[model samples]
Target: MGGLKVLCIAIVLINGQTIGTVAADGPFPDEARRMRSANEFLSPALRAEQADPIRNRGMLWVEQGERLFAQPPPPGGAQSCASCHASPETSMRGVAARLPAVDAESGQLVNLEGRINDCRILRQSLPPLDYETDELLALTAYLTALSIGEPLTVSIDGPASAFYAYGQQLWSERQGQLNVACTQCHDQSVGRKLRGDTISSAVPTGYPAYRLEWQTLGSLHRRLRSCQLGVRAQLFELGSREYLALELYLKSRARRHLIDAPALRR
Candidate 1:
């Protein structure tokens, strides 16, 4: 079984601190409580799309991803992902909910896109795909789409704890000339409109998300990079440890939130 396969079925704990369920975070203050769930703050139009994935434009990427998953790999490759896994519905359902799993071979944490790249290089005998490319997004969206409606139950205990802590630090620490941390906008200003968009919880439930600005489905790292650029900070490499760490942290915060990949965002 794959690394994510085991975690998805076996470990089912909420990855981070939950509001009211446990002692809420003190550093976050009462304002943070307002940002409990991404579902809470959305316009009627956008929220309608969130509830109906079938109508969402991002589903176009998922259809592309489905075709890509079954097609044979480029010349000289062993086989396509579908050749080994059979149906994505049976094998990949809920897989994304457990992602950014710990890589047993390297002991380094890897996100869904990074894991897909690693598999292509090692298993498919192909070069790593470029980050944020359409192919990668398609594949990621297809798999993550299977897990839609399932809660994010990524483990943050034991081997994953260190990465979680580092991710937590990064989430709290301010960056850039503006001196704003993710906590400032997401945590402090949950409902407030920042440049016309309501501030979300920074939770990672919706990813491989379709942003009106991008006009396409994009990876979570892409969104994070936007946040960095917004704050005037140096952008990390797409699949860098920093992005992965931040991803883990964000997923943790969205503990019980259902997977909403390829979601539309304004």
Candidate 2:
């Protein structure tokens, strides 16, 4: 696949049982078929680790996020996130799965991370949180965890149509020194081996995830940036419109796939 020898990896459930082997060299599955989460491509050990909170390092960020959510607004501000939206368990449930949407008030596209900063700047009257910072990652992790099993339902209708179209275009356009596009690996070569790692369907269900390579929780944009670097493409800023549009497209493609934020990945 993609000029590399295909390699099959066991698809294991969290209970440590091998379900099957993904066909590494097979053609892309039909769109009518149900989309698979990237978690299904993980090694058994990593799958088990992701299912166990004690062993999953990503949970630490979720815990920190819970604290930040409950914190009072900085002096002079009137509301904390928790103040506007009560307990996350009740209010934030399923919110992450529908994100990267057009914010009703601002009329701008906002993902989970963008929403958090929006609240900080507009509501709390504070500076926007830096991208990839611990605080931002933590809050994103916590909120995403609330919708762990919710299916993605990001809308591309109305004003969001343009962004979604741009994202789809970016997905297929070739770039970088390798002259590769995202579709080459994530679509055409999915389930194949790349440097000992299985190529997944490029699902975004695992944002704010803890990657073994990074050894810390990171956002989807962070992962996107890494992929650009791997391809030697021009890298966009963390919150750049290009990345945001791409994110919207990914989530839209992943419609109905259950979310697994703070996910564990190799």
Candidate 3:
């Protein structure tokens, strides 16, 4: 009699486990399928607008950044960016689209500005510029404009693999005394409200944006770092290896999402 009771309980437990698994994975799989189907509705022309090309009419920032590029850094330093990069036609050629790539030697991801600053500090022996400064914004505008129509290219390979994995792990891992992952806010419950702001799909293609909240332009890294601070998680150093890794991962996920460089966002 006891053996029969034990067998019955085991059968019930197995059935309950199966039901829970189906309940968890089922809805998400169906929703993913629907999203894939909806993706085909996107238009390339609309995507082009997101690239945020610098028109000659309202593109004073690009020219200003260009001028700054020709000016020498503070104190004493090597020649300006124009010295070796020369002209956008030659040096800046094919550069805009090739950003946010993995660097094997450094085992990190590197965006265009990160690359520029690396050169400025190491080669020129100068201090790196702060994120979202006038100098940084102008320089980014000028560089991105150089590759206006070129497609963005980001890689996830070699040492970048570990960094990418770490970033994705962080994206899903719950944090904050409130206990939430980025996926909870951005992926699962998109279009919801947080502090009266409509939460849209958290895409990164439109980075280096001018945010209404901050009332100024900011880099993608700054945004990520800010989010970390919001969760009370340890903030990564500016232009750190982890930031580069996260940048590559995020940019790759945002591939073909539209390059809204220097975007104006609320």
Candidate 4:
């Protein structure tokens, strides 16, 4: 288990307040409340005990991801993820649980898909895929499968310490023209309606989720950026340091949430 010493210290200094369950607000606040009222975060034991049907579906995605990694696009310049990821079980071991990680060089926290696209751009020299694209989903499904029973872990050590602290500050700080913080909606009024849709608790265990509204699957970072944009807050570039730092902070909050990919959301 990776200890979040820096994260804890930073959180204490930044928040200086009690941590409570996400609040309820919005049009369908009741529905949101119903969704998370008795929510039990996904634990290692529960992950191990999950029924075969669910695990099988996850496995199917993993297998498809593996195939996608092998299939080259057009004039094959470089191979797919298998060229490096190698064994899905071994290469991706414990990866999903450690994601939304802080990158040492760039000093940013990056989600699983962000890291993958980074690899694709740097190692493979291929253009990064759009968020929640089929390629990204397959890869996420495959990597997440490797840590089905492992505990989620994100580090806030060394260079990441400062970034994590920055993220924590961002999490608590109230801003935007609406003068509302993410906590106000996500944590404070967790079960509520923004417009016509229900406000979920905003857990991040799942990524590259299939959304009915978008009619496509996408990464958590994309959603986060969208949220920021929605609030008319400052929008960071994809894979930017500030964005990544915020990602790490958010993942820490969803320590034990279940990974629900291919999820249907409005």
Better of 1 and 4 by TM-score: 1
Which regions of candidate 3 are displaced past 4 Å? 1-61, 72-75
> In lDDT terms, how accurate is model 1?
0.76
What are the per-residue Cα lDDT tens digits for candidate 1 across 1-266?
25734222221122222211222333432333343665556567876775564557777778778878887888988778887788668688878888887898899998888878887888888787887888999889888877776777788888999999999999999999889999888878877887778887776776888888998888899999999999999889988999998898888776766676667777
RMSD of each: 8.4, 10.6, 20.9, 13.3
Give the per-residue lDDT digits (tens) of candidate 4, residues 1-266.
48834322110011111111332232332323333411233334433422233432334455567567655643544656777766656667778878776666875567787888898888787888775567677888767655554444666677667877888788778776767787787777865666775576666554554444565656667777778878888777766767677877766655544344433344
* Residue-level lDDT tens digits of model 3 in 98-194: 6777655775567878877887898777778777677777787667655543434555566566767877787788877667787787678766667
Greater-TM-score candidate between 2 and 3: 2
Most TM-score-accurate candidate: 2
Pairs in steric clash, model 3: none
lDDT string for model 2 (140-164, tens) is 9988888777767789999899889
| Sort order, TM-score high to low | 2, 1, 3, 4
lDDT values of the candidates? 0.76, 0.81, 0.59, 0.59
Stretches > 4 Å off in candidate 1: 1-35, 52-54
How does candidate 2 fare on TM-score? 0.86
Superposed by TM-score, candidate 1 places the C-alpha of residue 59 at a distance from the truth, in angstroms, of 0.6
lDDT of 3: 0.59
